[model samples]
Target: MLAEERLAVILETVQQKRSVKVSELCNLLNASVSTVRRDISTLAEMGKLTKVHGGAIALSENFAAVEKDMEEKAHLFLKEKQAVAQYAASLLEDGDFVFLDAGTTTENMIGFLPKKDICFVTNGLFHAKKLAQRGFRVYIPGGEIKCSTEAIVGAECACTVARYHFTKSFLGTNGVSVSAGFSTHDVNEAQIKSAAIENSIQAFLLTDHSKFDQITSVTFAQLSQAQIITDRLPDAKYRSFTTVKEVL
Candidate 1:
């Protein structure tokens, strides 16, 4: 295999296994330890993965640090988002007021929602038109638009979220851990998310399993605030945080 192919395999294996040993990579890639070590060192230097004692691990925190725009995010974990959205929509009933957090996962909710009388209050600028097109009552507060996430955040948006109490709220987060709860990289976005959870009757956090055990810059709400709706759990270590609804 070429050097590039070897590097790609190493990264993929590290991501799939979260962490990988030098021996494992040697056997998997049919490469010598020195060659695998060089690949891991190069990837580590490029900030693609974290180099460990004997191997490398995918650095989710590093990925979380450099935030991706909505267009980039929408394509990731598509099937998992679909499953979570379907399950989230199932929790909705007729005549319920909801807050849909600005995220690719929560954006999928509208497509899965039951055809019923429901009103949506969202900070997701990208979500408004789609919700309106679907014949649901959609409300987006006027605030400064966040270019990266296409979210309306800051004090004005937080105030808007606070004014109305939602029957149920579905939120998305960068990280959801027992210690840090729901966290994101942006503080301005965090304020709005925290407000939505506070003003809602029931809060649900939608995230993929990758979010577990990783924390971002700003923590929005505590783990106890929202019931987690995820595709799967890496382990039962998250039991103390909240009730987890695993779609798997």
Candidate 2:
């Protein structure tokens, strides 16, 4: 294929999939590795895509700044969230002190939680109720509830989270980027999530493939601060910073 045609195909694939490996692009373009790499570089220079280690990612788009309602978010990527949540829930053991972040994926985890002697500390009103109803000991921090996302967030929440060191923490993020790290749209929510991760022995981020390469307003932690459990990892370079468990 001509260079222009090859570049067009490469851009389209990255835009559609959010990321694409150079080898995969080569096969799609019927071009050699060098040709593909050169085309990628050209596109990268044109600011059409981001060139990473062995692949390219789509240019980051501005996702909605306002948080979605819990019901709206619950239906998106439901299968993927279930997979990631189930895997996260399985990691729990008896006598573990867990910090479960306020999000749909973390909420999904409550159903799959093993009937272990696990204690959960959460800032999610619904999460606390669910965990309690499921016969697990659960605690909720004192804070103002953010109605849009149904998350308890404020200085009080962050302060309470800082006082307790957890055995494990399962967090959710609006975006995950190599540069900006794990981010969310709300500063209050970010503060609480940061406090939880900082006071935990091990922190895990429960995210799906769509979050990769995206960035949000506030960064709670760096890429090295937490391991990731996702349904799919769109880029291999994320592995360079921390462990990523792709359940799919």
Instruction: Supply the global lDDT for candidate 1.
Output: 0.87
TM-score winner: 2
Q: Residues 1-248, candidate 1: write the lDDT tens digits.
A: 99999988888887776667899999998989999999999999988898865777677533356677888988999999999999999999998999999999999988888989999999988799899998999999878899889889889989888999899999999987554568899989999999989998899999998888776677799888889999999868677767998997
Candidate 1 worst ten-residue window by lDDT: 57-66
CA lDDT, every model vs. true structure: 0.87, 0.90
Off by over 4 Å in 1: 1-63
Q: State the TM-score for model 2.
A: 0.77
Model 2 agreement with the true structure over 1-248: per-residue lDDT tens digits: 77788888999998887667789987888888898999999999998988865777778733335667889999999999999999999999989999999999999999999999999999988899999999998899998989988899999999999999999999999989875689899999999999999999999999999988786677799999999999999889999999999999
* C-alpha RMSD between model 2 and the true structure: 9.3
Q: What local lDDT does model 1 show for residue 69?
A: 85
What global local distance difference test value does model 2 have? Answer: 0.90
